[model samples]
Target: MALSPEDVIKKSFSATHLRRGYDETQVDDFLDEVVVELRRLVSENDGLRTDLEDCRASRGVASGQGAAAPAAQGERHEDAEDTQELEALRRQLAECQEARAAAERRAEEAQERVGAAERERDEARSSLEAASAGAAVGASAAGGDGEDPSSIISLAQRLHDQHVAEGESTRARLIEEGDTYRTTVVAEADERSAELQRTGQETHDRLVAEGQATHDELVQTGQSRHDELVQTGQSRHDELVSTGEQTRDRLVAEGQASHDQMISEAEQQRSTVLEDLHGQESALSATIGGLQSQERDLRERLRAFLSDQMERLDGSRPTS
Candidate 1:
């Protein structure tokens, strides 16, 4: 089951309510680029298929005519030339298929990156939750301390969850877009190929009709034309492949860099939140210690006052 462009456009993610997450605009922009690149790849694939079909049809017609014609040394030489041309065409077609496969591989890689980012985000969220739970337990152990630290921890947890959720959502969206693009490109290529086949059949028939009288001359001319076309196609294919590779590399690099930056920032924020919590806990402990000291001093003072009063009372009783 392949996702189409419409599916990508309709894809949505769960909102991270009350949390800050990835920038929606940036995510959307990146998706748009993926769609555009997919479209370009599809178009190129279709064109390459058309060219391959044309070359095959041309070869078939040339072979059929050669079989019907008189076999001379010159004709044999021409046949050999035709065979070479067909071989070149086959090689070109193979190269085209390879290029298409490479493009698909790149799309898969993009999805893999999306998966990695999601995994990292999930890990971060889990770790933060664990840390928050730990802090809560420590606070409880310290005589069920005040709500301030707990509240702060709660807020930090929410923030962490929100950020992680946003990154996850963005990554999911990107994966969906890639799936959709791949499906759409393949379908379009198939349709274009069928159309090209029909067109090639009609053109082959016309060429056969035209070759009846001027077979030798046309063969020579066609060889020259075929050579020219093959060279041109090769050059064009090389340029397209080079450009596509460069674009893919740049996009992948940018995505990775962005992901790393986001993770680094999130870690820093979590560390800061933890530090604040620890500092507050220390302050509370010091205050409790001071209160205990004051309590002990008060107890000693009261006992001394009681002893003094008793002595005065004894002294006042003369008969005793």
Candidate 2:
């Protein structure tokens, strides 16, 4: 099916998970290229169609004059040449259409892969969150289960440590995955960009060469038309090159920004998690310290009371 620019612009991908998948920005940039290529194809096809119609009309005119003119042989040869040129244009148009369709298919496949990765990441996050929540609730409930404060505190501390460890591991894994994926993507983009530039240069050279040859051959017959074709081909080549360069730069900038943003967010989240863990640890330490202080005071009071009771008993024994 044919894809439109709006479909690309409106497509959304989940952002919270940075698993091993196509970068969202890269995919969007690729879709943007596809859209540009599609537009170019359409425009070129329209021009070719118009040129074809003109050629047919010109041929009709030449045929009308053929009946009254003595240059029938020359006109017939010209008509055959026009037919060949028209066929070539038609073939080029067909190829452009086919390329457009292929590009659309690729874009769709990329979107699908990205969507699947996002769904998988979502599921993993949900499971981890649920597990952490359940563990927290269990730890809170254990304090009311007739367990001593020390045991409860120990259990809570272990759970906290476990959670912290898991968080660190997950964070590390995600960062590594992101780095690997980003590296791979950037490399591929660079390589692809270079290849495209080379291909564009080659195509431009070939087209210019062909235009020069045609201009030489038809200089006497249609010099103005030949010049126009050359100018148009040169302009088209320049536009394609400029567009490719602009796209490459934009994709590079976006990829860097995305990488930086991901790193910054991960750091912020890590900091927040560490801060909460530290606060919890500090609170538990204070509670334990307070309990110990109370126990020491009770011991001192019991010792003093026993000593006073012993002295009173001695006095009441009549100095024995």
Task: State each candidate's clash count.
Answer: 0, 0
> What C-alpha lDDT do the candidate models reach, one value each?
0.71, 0.63
**Best model number under TM-score:** 1
True-vs-predicted CA distance for residue 242, candidate 2, Å: 60
Give one digit per residue, the lDDT tens place, for model 1 in 1-320.
75445666778877632334468798899788777766776787677666555554443333435654554455567656655655655565455556557658878987898888888888888888887787777667764554666676777688787878788788988888888877776665555555555555655565465455456655664576567557877888899889978987997898899889877877777788789989999999999999999999999999999999999999899893
> Where does model 2 exceed 4 Å of error?
1-147, 221-320
Clash count for candidate 1 is: 0
Question: Judged by lDDT against the true structure, how good is candidate 2?
Answer: 0.63
Number of the top candidate by lDDT?
Answer: 1
Clashing pairs in 2: none
Over 98-172, each residue of candidate 2 has an lDDT whose tens digit, in order, gives 655555565555555555655655565566566556656676777677655555456656665666566556555
Clash pairs, candidate 1, are none
For candidate 2, report its TM-score. 0.28
